[model samples]
Target: MSQQTTETTPARLPAAARRGGGPPWMGAGMPAEKSMNFLPSAKRLMGRLRPHRLQLIGVITLVVASVSLSVIGPKILGHATDIIFSGVIGKQLPPGTTTEQAVEGARAAGNDSFADIIAKANVLPGVGIDFDRLGRVLLLVMLLFAGASLLSWLAGYILNGVVQRTVRQLRSDVEDKLNRLPLPYFDKQPRGELLSRVTNDIDNISTSLQQTLSQLLTSLLTVVGVVVMMFVISPLLALVALVAVPLSVWVTKQIAKRSQKQFVAQWKHTGALNGQIEEAFTGHELVKVFGRQREIEASFAAKNDELFKASFGAQFVSGIIMPSMMFIGNLSYVAIAVIGGLRVASGAMSLGDVQAFIQYSRQFTQPLTQVASMANLLQSGVASAERVFDLLDAEEQSPDPVKPAPLTDRHGRVEFERVSFRYEHDKPLIEDLSLVAEPGHTVAIVGPTGAGKTTLVNLVMRFYELDSGRITLDGVDLTELRRDTLRSEIGMVLQDTWLFGGTIRENIAYGNPEASEEQILAAAKATFVDRFVRSLPDGYDTVIDEEGSNVSAGERQLITIARAFLSNPSLLILDEATSSVDTRTEVLLQRAMAALRSDRTSFVIAHRLSTIRDAHLILVMESGRIVEQGTHAELLAAEGAYHRLYHAQFSQPAIDVDEATPPPAVPGAPLLRQR
Candidate 1:
């Protein structure tokens, strides 16, 4: 007979949706806006590079060498220009006349200013240009430029290696941290949002480091080298160039400050959006069944629009930085050009020196512009780093004992001693509950939803710890035994079957990897899984899809039961294990479980009264307390809570009393129940 199963409530809505006031996207639980700590986050990110200190030092050395060469090249070219200019003027002078004679002649012609320029130029009055010297200077300048390029490339190569290694280590740390976190932590965090932090945010950090690190380092060094060269050529021109520094700094600072918030919002929405998408896809069938496609689409559109706004705001604000810096730099450039021309004409500076200083000025402004332009990438990367760091800093689960107690025997005797637990502080679910199940007995638990039926078995598995009391196995406190040790002797088959994407044979073997082929086949036959496997084209080799959707629900449940049978555990837990199978199949499963339960303890949670009629002990639970405990006939005669539950299941119209009747008890089929 098929029993009617009531659908449980959908997952709890976000707090905002429950209150009935907020944007549609807020249903995703969008994170509240928090002020970004830019400097601290940036500093923390740099600290990730600490392990590569030696490599960084090498990179710095190379950059310094490269910048130095670059700085000196223009000055050498300027000297070559001076040589050419002086030779041209000397060639125009009268034959056999010295440089002093040319100056004297200009002065006598009442051209004192021109005479001063002639003196500063140091013209050889009777000589033409020195072609040999000019050629040598030119060749030397080309070599300096080439050497600078080579060193710069080498520095970038080493820096790239350092960034990749650092990011790799960071990924490994996040993965490890995830495993160390407590189960409750996962309950509170959406899987999609967590995935974004692990994937998208980390990728952003890697890209930021790759694109900005080398360029920022080179730009700053170039700025310093250019300034020094500028002062060497003419201190006045260098000071004029420096007037733009404060303005550029102010511009970058202001823009970065505004854009930082938008970047934070952008990534935050990205995670929220990913979470929505994940949930929608995971429950796609449920959505379609309820005709909620439009609602889901609306929610998605709202979140997408919010993300677009955040991304646009971040880019638009940071985009203003380059043009503003360029304007300030251009103003400085015009001032230097005017002052340099006047100085040259007045004989206060040589034409070659002025030419070189102009080059230095351009070099100075260009790097500043480059640095300013990189603000967008830097801010976005730092924002992502902050998210990744938050995950790494989450509180971890309590550690296992340094010295754990040993479990020498495989006896399945279990006991709960005055246990107390609650998911929340103010709401207690189970209080001072105690029970005992002897070895070789089947204990059946029956209860309505939220009656603490599943919670009781979960406690025995140590999926959670009790608030006030401890559980014991074979007279030993469960806490003293290592979790892995305790779990190794136990096997569980839940109502919701979980199977990985693999062949049927592989899935069955997952429970006991070392089990021989004969053992696997025996387990399959015992659970009646072999009956279905033989009908498939590939038999045991049939591949299950990732979602296990290719098989029927009853078939999936049978596979899980077969897996548990293969484990040969000392204790077994079957929660609604036979609910998905038909009445005939359930009869066969009951027979298989009877054989499997011989000389081993078992806990069965069931709503169908027919399944547990033969159990050794039946526990009737109500509001976290056991209201009745006894055999089916004994409880029916007593007319207690169990009598009411038994009568309720048989009285239902959908369950025909004759068809719902359980078969005669098989020898050694001991079990317990609570409802």
Candidate 2:
């Protein structure tokens, strides 16, 4: 309500260094190697999964069942082949004996044994094999395969539900963390990078959970089971297959080591690319005004190309792992086949045993290759997890007091007692500054840009804690009172007006949502906002777009003023609150502010000298120090900093106030001495 210039004055405002002085989109990209503690990160990742321990155990059990069932099929089929051979050679399982006992007895019969005679029995013409035994064996094998598949499906179903719920919890935690983080954290981080953490990084973990996790488990189980089967069938053949294991492991490790680096770069470039796109789109107007479309496109293309190269390197390197392991596996198979055949010819092994052994060898090598291929996806997932956990592990702000003192009586008596504050430890901005504003007084603060005017206000609001001294409101230390309690009694109107997407009535009622429609209308009328609202097609119901683009800048300022009026706080801080309105509109606003500030204490920060001529007291600041303070007449007589600033602002046709005709003053306004 105070008379203050609403015109834009960039020179009087300091650049926000924490925002990094550019589009929020121009933040640095992710580092290539943030940390190399893989084992620790992996452990933490598993720790997160611990919540679903039951589901994981289910998956493992199903995997074991599935692998065992699959492994049994080949052995069953091999036994059937042996039976058909016996039928052809006119030999049968010894009368009333099961196939197992007959085979063991024939093996003990040695060279030209009954096993060989029985195998030749199936060769006789018109000597049909027994169909009964073959039918039962085939049926059992089919049933085992179906049961294994059914278990796998159930395991996958359970895992899907578990993964989704786990991700939901993770996303919720990140959202909560954002609200608790201190202002400094946001200042140093990019909007897009934070977004990537929530969206991209978390999504990668989801994919790994849905696919890589299960695949890795199945592959490991297959490898272990096959190795055991190979040794049981024939130790010599198993030894030959075992040779491929070490070679596959060594090759996989070498490729993964290189691919891991590429995967890290890929994700890093992805974050940087996202940041550039966000910046370009958000500031499209500025880009066009400066004719920077080509430049932005160029920058985008460069980042995209970098991402492409990294992605290609990671994927291609991982892709080779499967084929390389297959080659070694095939070589092992050939060696095992030749050795087993020679042993069979010498009557040391049966054809069925040799066939089963070869099958197990193939199974053993397949899973090793699968595991190697999935290593890329797992590595990338771990990288993403590391970034997410880092955000969760960040240091939080100091906790609120368990029992805070209540701010009572609500007298707007504010005092700063030797306060000092600095954004950085080495560069002290405000050193031992002190001032006082009595109840029901209009105190004006005028200073050049970066002179710490805003910093002082920030300290009073406790946006940043002071390094020393204490601020008192109504004779009580501000720190002892709850922030919400202190802030509730004080109303603020910042220069950059923020009006969300909502109706005019809603925007005005934002400060006091519980206010009735009549109260909202009254507040709007006080600030002349009602006049404009009535002119709109929907009146007060007219919805404002994002950034309030539908209304002119002046109209937006009026609505903000209306919001402040609706709050009806005990104290007010106006940081060039009327800087956007025209001179005519400003005059109306000044009357509204006068009525609003009549009873409540106010601190008005302004750059224009004429606006604060009737203030009860004025403080002139320079380089974070209060250099002069007094009423207009007293400061002009002193002929100091305020004198120079006053004369500079009104050098032409200066109107001098006669002692006989005193400037107007609100009745009962306190007069505080300048120190």
Candidate 3:
């Protein structure tokens, strides 16, 4: 299928693309076919084979053998029919021959002409042909057919079951890979497309297994098997039979080329539509608040129109192949019939041969058209595979070269040495910066907007690499630690709390799956989650909706905080929002934070300077650089950026940030330290 170049919203393009999007064809020459290789997905799929290989092997073997039996049975029947019809069973004699004469001749008791006697001896009587043996032959054929059919059904059931389990296995694998994927892969693709690979593509492949799928390999094998048999019957007739093969192939190729493109368009549009719906539904609250029902509907309608066009084009093209093939098949059948009949009359061939040829022709056409549609599946699978592989291909943070030095005591000494970094090198987010926090001390990062407060903590947590500097936790470089181990070593509380759909206990246990029940209870109590848990009808077992959509924001935050506390990491970073909870809940949360942060290396990114006034160090950052570093007492004495920021926030009842209050972006705030 020819691809139509889509013009993205200019605003949405990355800076590099925004400069020109591309020469003429944007993202062209890029593999329109998904991935270049299937090795990775194959390897991943094969890994699951260890557990299911034996079952799969059994199913595959049965399917192949059973399908072959089925196919062979029909050809055998057609051949047998030809044999029966072409004078193999001469029960009745030629005209004018009497049955009594034949019996008497056989007994040598009748006086007749030599020719008459010969006819009588050679055939059964003219009118009274026996039907008994024919019935038995038919019964035998039926028995063979029934057995083959039963085996085919059993094979189908087994293969179908195996395919279903395999799909499940694939889904789990993709999901696990998603968790491990580097963030860049997600940045380059859409979520709906990824969702399609995990859900839609696997389903498509599984559905094909319901019957003998029209996969190219199976269809080719079946066709080849039938063709070889046809040749065995009559080489000349087989050559004649192949006259229409090329024509059928050409027709299929045309249809397939057109259909493949349409199929791709159909899927792409479906993903776009799905993305729109997902976005709208996920942000339903924002939509309601803005009262933009019509706006959302218009956006949905636009995507729907595109989807309809793609669907109509795809289905219409796909729908044409069968009828077109059938038409050709009919023509081929008529040609074979006319030619075979003349040849038979001329003593060039037997009637049985013509009958079998007809069966062979039908087999070829059905699978040819069926095989044509299989390309559609293959293309779709490749598209889905490409998306999945893109994720698997993303660059991960480099593993540490040296084993991280394990520290016994939690000495919260944090230091940044000439740290400098940027998400994009051309646009520096955090320029040269440095700071230190003594053990047993708290560090506060304060910035106006894009000042890099969060970036500071991000660096502290080793979420990103330092461009030309090193960040050390107790004198150990952050990069010299296992990612999972490092992450587990630090606890975090963020402004946006995430919760999965599950019972309260499950969500809490997500942080520490191995935690004891008593430990969970203790953590819940510390974070003021006990009250909400007790209030639920089912207490801790009360289930939440996806993303904890069923619960209040405050409660969700508390649950997340409880999880962090339960972790009990040696180091903690809290990007606390200025937003407040209920007075009672606030008091409980403050007490919880104090307890959680006590004696641990703590970094707090906060706008409420009052909250972090007790920290041992207060570093104020601006324009990707640290402007001041000191205690509240020392900073208040310095009368610099920290003093102005603290006073500016409290000076007026309503003070607006000039040129927009720059909040941190992801890896937010340039940070107080370059590292």
* TM-score of each candidate structure, all chains considered together: 0.87, 0.82, 0.81
lDDT of 2 by residue, 366-479 (tens): 888788878888888878888888889888866566887777767798999999887667667788888898888888898777777867776777766789999999888888
| Weakest 10 consecutive residues of candidate 2 by summed lDDT | 1-10
lDDT of 1 at 125: 84
Q: Model 3: what TM-score?
A: 0.81
Model 3 poorest 10 in a row by lDDT: 1-10
RMSD for each of the candidates: 8.1, 9.4, 9.1
Instruction: Name the top lDDT candidate.
Output: 1
Sorted by lDDT (best first), the order is 1, 2, 3
Instruction: Write model 3 residue lDDT over 282-308, tens digit each, in one string.
Output: 667777887877777877787788779
Model 2 stretches astray by more than 4 angstroms: 1-19, 23-33, 80-129, 340-355, 501-510, 513-525, 528-530, 534-547, 562-568, 609-614, 632-637, 650-675
Candidate 2 global TM-score: 0.82
Q: lDDT values of the candidates?
A: 0.85, 0.78, 0.66
- Candidate 2 or 1, higher TM-score: 1
lDDT for 264 (candidate 1): 91
Model 1 regions lying over 4 Å from their true place = 1-26, 29-36, 87-96, 107-117, 125-131, 514-543, 654-675
